[model samples]
Target: MILQVDELGKMHSGKQEQVLFAHVSATIEEPTRICMIGASGQGKSTLLRIIGFMDREDQGQVLLQGKDRSKWVPREWRKQASYVAQQPVMLAGTIEDNLRVVSTLHQSVFDEKLAKRLMERAGLTEMAWSKPASDLSGGEKQRLALVRSMLLRPAILLLDEVTSSLDMHSKQLIEMMLMDWHEEEETTLIWVTHDMDQARQCSSRLWFLAEGTILEDVSTVDFFEEPRTQPGRKFLGIQSVRERKWSGEGINYV
Candidate 1:
C-alpha cells in the first residue's frame, strides 16, 4: 500500500464538539484513483486535510509506504505528497514565482521542462509560463495550482474540488489531465468533488462520506449501479445518466 489510515478519528472543539470522522480506515495502493463524494460539509475536505497532514487526527495512525507517519517528520511526508486546495493561493508575482514559493523540493530537483510540459498538458501553455498569477482566469489559476503541485512529482496527490468553478471546457481539460496522469504516471490520486460526473470520470473507486463517516467504499461501477447505503443513493441523485455518461463508460449499475 502506498498510504494507509487505521482507525483514524478527529473531533473539533467548538460551541459543540464536532466529530469529523471516527474509526475511519482506508488504504491507497499504487495507481489508485479514489474519488470521495458526498453532500457539502460532509467532511470530505476534512478527510483530505487529515491525509495531507494539514490537520492532525485526534486519534489513529497514518502510514505511508509502510512506515508510521506519526513517528516520521511531517516535512518529510510532505515531500512525498502534495495537496491542492479548492481555491488557488498564488503569490504576488509571476506564475513561476508562485510555484517557487510553495515548492518544497530543491531548485536543482525542479524539472523546468517537465513543468512546462505539464502546463501545456493542462491546457495553459499560452498564459501559464510567463503570465502574472494575479491576472490569470479562474481555470488558469486552477491549472497553475495543479502544475505547481506536480512539480514535486509527489507519489500521492490530494485534490479538493479543484474544478468546482470551471467552465465545461476547462473542466474537461482538467479531467483529461488527471486521467493522463493516472494512466501514464500511475500517480495515486484522491479527489473530493461534489460533481458526481467528474468523480465517476476520474475515479475507479468511490468513497461516500456523510455525517462524518464513510458510509460506502466500493467501485464506482458498483456504487452507481446499486448503492449499498442511503447516503450513497442520495448523493447519486445529483447526477443523471446523461451526466454520468460523460465518463465515456456507461454506468454498470449492477
Candidate 2:
C-alpha cells in the first residue's frame, strides 16, 4: 500500500464537541485516484490535512509505505508527499524561485530545464517562468501550485479542492495533467471535491463523508449505480432507486 489510514478521528476542544470522523480507514495503492465527496464543512479538508501530515489526528495511525508515520520525523514525511490547497500560497518571489524551493529538497542538482518542462506541461508556459507569482491570475496561480507540487515528484498527493476555483478550460487542463501523472508515475491521488460529475470523471474510487463519518466506500461505478447508504443515495439524487428497495451491505435509505 502506498498510504494507509487506520481508525482516524479528530475532535476539537469545545462544549459542542465537533468530531471529524471516527474509525475512518483507507488504503491507497499505487496509481490509485480517490475522490472524497461530501457536503461543505464535512471535514474533507481536515481529513486531507491529517493524511498530509499538516495536522495530527487526535487518534489513529497514518502509515506511508507500510511504516508508521508517527515513528518518522514530520519533515521527512512531508518530503515524501505534497499537499496542495484550494488557494495557491505563493511566496514573495518569481515562479522560478517557487519551483526551485521544492526541487532542491530531493535533488542534488536542480534542473531548470526540467522545471520549465513541468511548468509547460501544467499550462504555465506563457511568461509564467519570469513573472512574479503574486501577479498571476486565479487559474495561473492554481496551475503554478500544481507545478510546484509536481516538482517534488511525491509518491502521494493530497489535494484539497484544488480545482474548485478554476474555469472549465483550466479544470480540464488540470484533469489531463493529473491523469497523465497517475499513468506515468504511479502517483496516488486523494482529492476532496464537491463536484460529483468531476469526481465521477476523474476518480476510480469514492469515499462519501457526512457528519464526521464515512457513509460509503466503494468503486465509483457502484457509487453511481447502487449507492448502499441513504446518505450516499440522497447525496447522489437517486431517490427513485432507493424507493425501489434494492438491498446492499451499507446503510439503507429511510
Candidate 3:
C-alpha cells in the first residue's frame, strides 16, 4: 500500500477537551484522486495535516510506504507526503526565489524546464520570475503554491482547500491543472473540497467525513448515485430514496 491509516483518533485541544473524530481508517494502494468532503468542524483540514505529519493524531498509527510514520525522518516523510495549505504564503523575494526554495531545502538541483512547464500549465506564463512574489493576485498565489509543492515531486499531495478562495474560472483552471498533473506524475491526490461538483469532476474516490469520522468511503459514482448513510444523502441533498413506499391509495412520499 502507498499509505495506510489504522484507527486514527483526534481531539480538540483547549480549555475543554473533546473527541474530534475516531476510528478513521483508510488505505491507498495506488495513485488515484481522492476527495474528502464534509460540513464545517469535521476535522477535514486536521486529518490532512495529520497525514502530512504537520499534526499528530491523538490515537492511531499511520504507515507511509509500509513503514510507521514514527520510524521515518520528519523531512523525509514530508518529502513524500507534502501539503499545500489553503492560504498560500509567499517567501520574501521574487517568484524565482519562491520556486527555488523547495530545491534548496531538499538539496536537489532546480529543474528550470519542469518549472517552466508547470507555470505554463497553471496559466502563469505571463508572470515574471524577477517580479516580487507578494504582488501576485490571490488566484495566482494559490496556483504558484501548488507549483511549489509539485516541485517537491511528492508521491502523495495533501491539498487543504487550496482552490476554495479562487474565482470560478481560476478554480476550474486549478482543477484542470491538478487532474493533468495527477496523470502526468501519477500522483496520489488527497484533496479537501467543499464544492461537490469539483469533487465529482476531479476525484475518482470519495472519502465522506461525518459524525466525527469517515462515514463513507466509496467510488465517486456509487456515493453520488446512492449514499449508504443518511448524513451522506443529506450532504448530497438527496432524500431517502429507498424509504419511499408505494401505497395502495396513493404514492407515499416517505
Model 1 spans > 4 angstroms off: 13-15, 102-107, 238-254
- The residue pairs that clash in candidate 3, if any, are none
- Error of model 2, residue 48, in angstroms: 0.4
Q: Order candidates by TM-score, high to low.
A: 3, 2, 1
Candidate 2 per-residue lDDT over residues 1-254, each given as its tens digit: 78888999988544267676788988876668989999887788888888888988998888998999758787667766788988879978987877787756655466778778777776677765668889888777877888788767788888888887788877888888888888998888888888878889989999999767877879998898868887787788776544655554345657
Alpha carbon lDDT of each predicted model:
0.80, 0.80, 0.91
Ranking by lDDT: 3, 2, 1
Better of 1 and 2 by lDDT: 2
Q: Write model 3 residue lDDT over 1-254, tens digit each, in one string.
A: 88999999998875257888999999999998999999988899999999999999999989999999768999989989998998888999999999999999899999999999989878889999999999998888988999999999999999989897788877888889899889989999999999889889999999999998999999999998989998998888776645433223334546
Quote model 1's TM-score. Answer: 0.87
Candidate of highest TM-score:
3
Write the number of the candidate with greater lDDT, choosing between 2 and 3. 3
Clashing pairs in 1: 225-253
- Model 2 earns a TM-score of 0.90
lDDT of 2: 0.80
